[model samples]
Target chain A: MKTQKFLLTEQEMPRKWYNIMADMPTPMEPPLHPGTGQPCGPEDLAPIFPMNLIEQEVSTDRWIDIPEEILDRYAIWRPSPLFRARNLEKALDTPARIYFKNEGVSPAGSHKPNTALAQAYYNKVAGTKKITTETGAGQWGSSLAMCCAFFGIECKVFMVKISYNQKPYRRLMMETWGANCTASPSTETKAGRSILEKNPDSPGSLGMAISEAVEEAVSDENTKYALGSVLNHVMIHQSIIGLEAQKQMEMAGDYPDVIIGSAGGGSNFAGLAFPFARDKINGKEIDIIAVEPTSCPTMTRGPFAYDFGDTVQMTPLLPMHTLGHNFVPAPIHAGGLRYHGMSPIVSQLILDNIIRPEAIHQLETFKAGLTFARSEGYISAPECNHAVAMTIREALKAKEEGKEKVILFNWSGHGLVDMASYASYFKGELADHDLPQEQIDAALKDLETLPKPRQGGK
Target chain B: MSTFSTAPPSDDVQVRCPRLGHQVHFGYCRAENLGSPCFKALDCWYLQFDVVGYFKQTLSGADFAAAFVHQGRPKMQTLVDLIQQAKQGTPEEPSGPGKGSA
Candidate 1:
């Protein structure tokens, strides 16, 4: 009786990505220099990123035009379908209408390519021949690899070593796309070598891998670094997800009352929720939830302050919800969600109370994944399980309250290639690593040693 | 209830290893795939899954030896060569000098 799927034509795809910074309730705190404690400018970022992306990072413009070339390439997967999870709703038997923007349809099987394609295009235009990056679960690496293949640029990925050992096909996919992916703590770079020497069996955190990739990028003349998340430009490029969903929702004749997305470094969550967050900023009644893993509860447990984005303190200091730059979470199956820090923009939004963050356990998320797969016929990636789990929570809550609520979440990717994690789940081998309050307190104590941010971004 | 802090698997022979139908996650490492740390021979060349600590923890030394398959190119000094040098002792597990570390 109701529309089961909302589809958009390629021509209907948005030409401009939304910039939530323009409509934020308050201005963002400028990123600071670890050395000077002063605000960092373009020169501070030029060594690692192309000038085009740097511009977008600091951009206050409400909308930035997407280049036609990028749009042409995006047409291959752009205008991805929005599905009404009618089956999932029926399974839950709640009065909630569940919808998901299926980002798993992309070639890399994730929403990561939405920004990877844009980053590669900008770097190619800037005449950069090679890009170095870090991947947590290999989603970002594979997506960047595919984008680089289309642009004829070289891609080097430093994947977190645990993920390298856990998700091998994630490596195969990247290699097949013409990228070279190495495990972090390798002898390839100074940063990697030093970390390896310090603790050879170190499971290799995302922060450590980022330091290696950033070192590689800064050392080369023609090489630039690409990040999958936790940066402004990356999230800005990802806004296409929300923009398209807005159109699809209009077509479906319904608007979401609640928006949810899983937060890793926060781009996926910000991408789909920031547009609606704009409405919330303006007196609209909507609930925005950013779900995170209980194992690495940066959003729920960490403090908002200036911290290095990388473990080795090479990146400019961003005021974010950090679980200490050196702190590494246990090797959870959801590798992509293991970052110690979050995006500064998302951190600012959280500070302003524009969004709420909820932590979900690994076991609960896996259960939600299995439930959704059985009902919705799509196996969700482990990192994406957090959002799905939260969606189920809200749907059940609505049922308890006898209210019909519209629930929407970003289905960041599919878990078909990540079957090993699912296999572990089915076998009862996956352990839940809750962040002990003592560990959280120790990590916060580590942050107390760092230079405190100037109060008002002066 | 007090929480348990379990020792992480000595070598990353995670459950995914069997599911992927490979002994290790990145597959048998080749010279061309040195981009990965396991086969780097330069620093992380110790084939972790075949390390003595892991073998003693889960299975037998000879069993791990039999499962060890060499995949690197002929000219390249692979983990197979370095594992032989380590004497397969659990105490020497994490500190293997690898093969060609500078």
Candidate 2:
């Protein structure tokens, strides 16, 4: 298949990129080398993590406490607004009140900086020299690179091959941040070489990129791997978004009937829902829903089992909701949501039935995203559009039920980096790829290899 | 030392902690139904048990720091430790909640 690329004139460049990390609390855990298990020198992590993770624990009795110094340095486009979508409610002719926490204002244009700054900060403090990571849509990579530039850390990003080929401007953005960007499945590592040996022109998946990134970190003694999502610390760091939003909602004198977020490795969703989940656990009656692409329904369709988090299986087996380690999802425009497994914490919540999960098609999600962009003047990431679709559907149901409902969702990212996807959507050029049942079964079969529980409890 | 493939005819895989210089027999652990220990040295799991007890006991402050940092990498390990600590002696705590063999 011939790849389609978008060309943008200099004037077409986005006027601003918001850095929301400045206003958020830093994370507690610092960066350490995986192999050495030692605190990395600032120079050690300089290659991979160009920024540090600031630490802050969520407080039940008070609003989040963001340090002024960190905020001043990192908050280029922070204090993101929370909008009450009265017009959207009127369009639906429903009594449901819809509110959105807009994170599209940040540079790199997503909720990514919430952790990027924290990761960069920790790396800087640890004296690590650099950071290395993989990005699908380039938001996480660009966001990390931007944070690194701020901290004077070196950033290296292995972008997914297809996205790198299709989204040159995203690569350029990383370069603008002084990050060295390379397309995955390039001749950088043994893993990439092996994959390329099989299919020279294969459009790489996030799993493939993860393997490359891990390989880079494992091979290099100085560098540590920085994941954008899936880990607990990342979610913990991202909770500032939920913490702030919870405060902002209180300021608006409204409580959400339902909280929505799009899940890809589940960090953004957890970032928005964890605080509310705390409330729910403590007797708050609210619905928390996670929206994912049907193309990679790890929570909804996957088995809750112990599986290797990475394709190489170098990492320990984590018990989570997984579509198996080998499941390479069909390419969806919601590139961030195409991972094989959800975060362990998010998976546990879904397994325990604390949160509900729904999967949506790409076409419908993009349509909903377009509707939201036209209405609100901010284009959402394709992944974020899943929440938009779910919100619209719920609002319509509320109208039918004649019930006044309050809906709040995270506009986790902007689609400015996703103009190619929108162009495809407008030109009627996008199509959703559904994996064959045979392939899914093949992947599921690998789950049987996991170590099983003994016959009797000791 | 054998490495097991995800494919059929399952065998054993031996893994060594590069930092601790400890060798763990993954197959033996599976056969004996033992859970993987948390990487953090200060955690109860680390204090109470060892993956490879054959190592000479030399617990130092540096070792503790190393394990603590290693534990930070996998967020699940810390969470599992926290939850286990919270549920210790509580009726709600599952018997083997987060054990890999479970």
Candidate 3:
């Protein structure tokens, strides 16, 4: 019998988070200040984030210390278990050895707490009394709420009204953790009020919620806003995921040949891959794949014109850049897959060809999720399903080649809260919205005459 | 040809919204982008309900094509735009006086 689970003692937890910025082969450009169109500095971010976190955001120190206070909080869930997917291997009848770092075991039932605790601790240190944020699915909100409770800081979450009313469990979790959850468009701020006055029945949107949250944060000096993903600091805080996995894999006496993580704003994926990316930078040959949903196309395609019908059709053809609505696929059950952007760090890495980004279809992701749930006995969050789908694809490829490849992926979260998506899949309600290859090809042909999009500028 | 029911799921039925990255209801997806249905509404709600069929039945071909077919800038780009808009204390969504200007 082979060893199944690899556990790291609490003492073995990494003390510093890896910052890939210092190690990137080519440095990434800084985010531009929306108004000035110049590289944004710490002062630009000071309105919402604390000085400490902003320092981390701009720091390229390669290693940043995990504060003792944050370490104590992380100890409760740090050193999350790494397990070999022996069962999944048998189920797939593959020769590949699969390993997954279980992030679902965290308090918020996702990997979010890994950074939530760190962000909360930094806010506390900055003398912030309250934090304001917007939540789409409530994962980040609940995680921050729990961490804020531990730190005795007030948390105000402006959840989209639709989710506020429909998905009450995440809100309930936030309330249980002592955070004040408000439905956006609630007349709390001018932004919310403006939308509501226009349409009294507005269902509320993430954009609206963000406006409300940022308004509250900027208005009150003691209140700072926190984002769940898509920032360098957030990715830096999440690097602990991969750091621990490195140690656990050492114990298992195996090294992964391929690393896969589903990318949304890219924090969770970055958390697990940046450490390995460092090794790759130092001449280690490894396949680093960032999985994304086909629904949310990012870092995948450039501007192109697609005619509605066939390869020969030319009448209805329009440049996607001009129309602003070329092939935006339908939304998927995977919440992370819906995000239209990748983290700047991840985006830069893709540009450098250090990381490969692949888009998986909605139906295929769900199918992989079910296969994973049945064999691994843990249902994955829809976002995590993309990684599972890719992993299955890689494992099957290894089988076809008769190779015993080692594969590792981040099990970002459990799907207990997302069982409804699985239910829809079982009911045959899910569909794939990927455009046919011919349509895409025809669209590309038309792009040669169109105006080119500005690259890497605000 | 599809086996799934064309009837819409109850208003309470929620799926993880790809645009917002959270679970949202059919009610919101239908009209969240102001009075018009969200551009992704047909693509998103197709699974839970006969979203494409429903939209086809309710909207003219041009309107249906307009709502779901034409696309916008990437969400990442939109987010960057939102940050600028938010800094200027302007609402990014097209509501109120901001409608049509966007």
Candidate 4:
């Protein structure tokens, strides 16, 4: 009866991903090599990444064309539906029109495949035999595994230990797709061994997982490493989400007044909001929000600096919002949102004051997730609850202000696989974990121990 | 990946590789190590995977994005097997034990 779903045909999918690097207000600081303390060049990354992806990582081109092969694979699930949340609106009793891009329909059940397919396609073309990567909650690993299956490449996923146990389905999904999934801190890599030695009962962190994945990818000539979020290229591939939203919103005869998505490593939020962020940079009136959990408040409490991306100091120094890399996050149910850093692009945008980052507690996020699942009829992944909570917050604020507003967010994926989190929530086993300021300060203090960012290396 | 219980040099002991269950020296394979040892896989998935040696020496940062980082996918089969769908409970009601939120 009402205009509910805006659908796009395969042919209608955008051909090029929007790159925010070309439009950033401030030039980004180049990533530095760990050993040299100098800016890393393409050859330095040649070991772990194909040259094609390395180019995409550093490309400042406003629009980079998507390879036909990648687009063909994307046709399987591209042009995911954009829906106006009529039920959610009625439940909120607000005048705001809420819209969400459904990314759960992919084979991997998340926006991760948007890049996984792309990464797999490029590596396949590059004659790469396999990809090694890390996952916090298993979404990216399985997505990559499925992409590798389609492309006839091999995949290895190092899933964080806590999530490996919490979400059994995540590991099974990866294994079913033929990717090897393992628990971190298993004494497989030098990094993992060192960590296990120090704390035998360590619940592995994303930082440790990255170290393990990078070690394997770098040591093998035929394998390369792929990351799910927080990097320039991963976010670039995810632009398909936001680009599609732009066209879909026009079909609904509306544009978002405020845009939001949960930020773990920042890819999903970047995927659904960066295209709009481009419009905002060009003087469009829009509010872009990146939400994260209070348990691991990298953006809200972390500093904007050049920091290592992993714990064992095996990765390069990226300019991002970080609580120190050595800081281990509290084991929150939103396992995907449990990192110590934000994406470099996201950090730079916040520095330029273009994107607004918000932090929500675990219990409130669970409440928001439950609210949406009951009304909208789709369970959300725990990580996505952060955005849903913020969207509801914005909608209620609109009502209190007596103003009609358009609220948009990425319903990044469904939580059916993560029902364990909800089960824990219903059982009252999950609690809001707020990192005290003292811990945040101590973590930031650890950054002082690392080599500083290049003073003038623009 | 190997099952030969060779002792590791130094503190790095060879444990079962989480992916394939092979007895790999600590840190021998990243996916095997960085993965959740909080749980373990059944076998060593890639034991003789030897194209591994050809890749150039790993640069100090995995080239830079893989380290002192902060915290940070999905897929699946049908409705019944993966996980128990939230028992169809009302969101407002507290079913679990403990301090329920107001």
Best by lDDT: 3
Give me the iRMSD of candidate 2, please. 19.2
Error of 1 at A137 (Å): 4.0
lDDT of 1 by residue, B8-48 (tens): 23333442221112123332221112222321211111222
DockQ of each: 0.04, 0.02, 0.25, 0.04
Error of 3 at A211 (Å): 0.4
Q: Rank the candidates by lDDT, best first.
A: 3, 1, 4, 2
Give the range where candidate 4 chain A is weakest over 10 consecutive residues by summed lDDT.
Answer: A324-333
Q: What would the per-residue lDDT of candidate 1 be over residues A381-425, giving only the tens digit for each residue?
A: 887999999999999999999999999999999988777677777
lDDT for predicted candidate 1 compared with the true structure:
0.71
TM-score of chain B of each: 0.23, 0.22, 0.61, 0.23
Off by over 4 Å in 3: A302-325, A438-458, B1-16, B20-27, B39-102
Proportion of native contacts kept per candidate: 0.00, 0.00, 0.27, 0.05
Give the lDDT of residue A101 in candidate 3: 96
Chain B alone, candidate 4, TM-score of 0.23
Candidate 2 vs candidate 3: the DockQ winner is: 3
Residue A173, candidate 1: how far off, in angstroms? 1.9
TM-score of chain B of 3: 0.61
- Model 2 C-alpha lDDT per residue in residues B37-96, reported as the tens digit of each score: 223111211112242231124334443323222221233332233223222322111111
Report the error of model 3 at residue A26, Å: 1.9
Tens digit per residue, CA lDDT, model 2, A94-152: 88888888877678788888778777777776776777777755777888899888889
lDDT of 4 by residue, A1-458 (tens): 99889999999999999899998877887765555657667776677779999899899999999988888899998899999999999999999999999999998888989988998999998999989887755777889999999999999888867667766787899999999888875687766777787667766654456666766776668988776666689889999999999999999999999999998767899999899999998999899999987655677777676565445555455565766655544434565564445677787788677898898977899999989988999898777888999999999999999889999999999877766567767877555545546756777887887765433224
Which stretches of candidate 1 lie above 4 Å from their native place? A159-166, A182-212, A307-317, A323-331, A433-458, B1-102
Poorest 10 consecutive residues by lDDT, candidate 1 chain A: A324-333
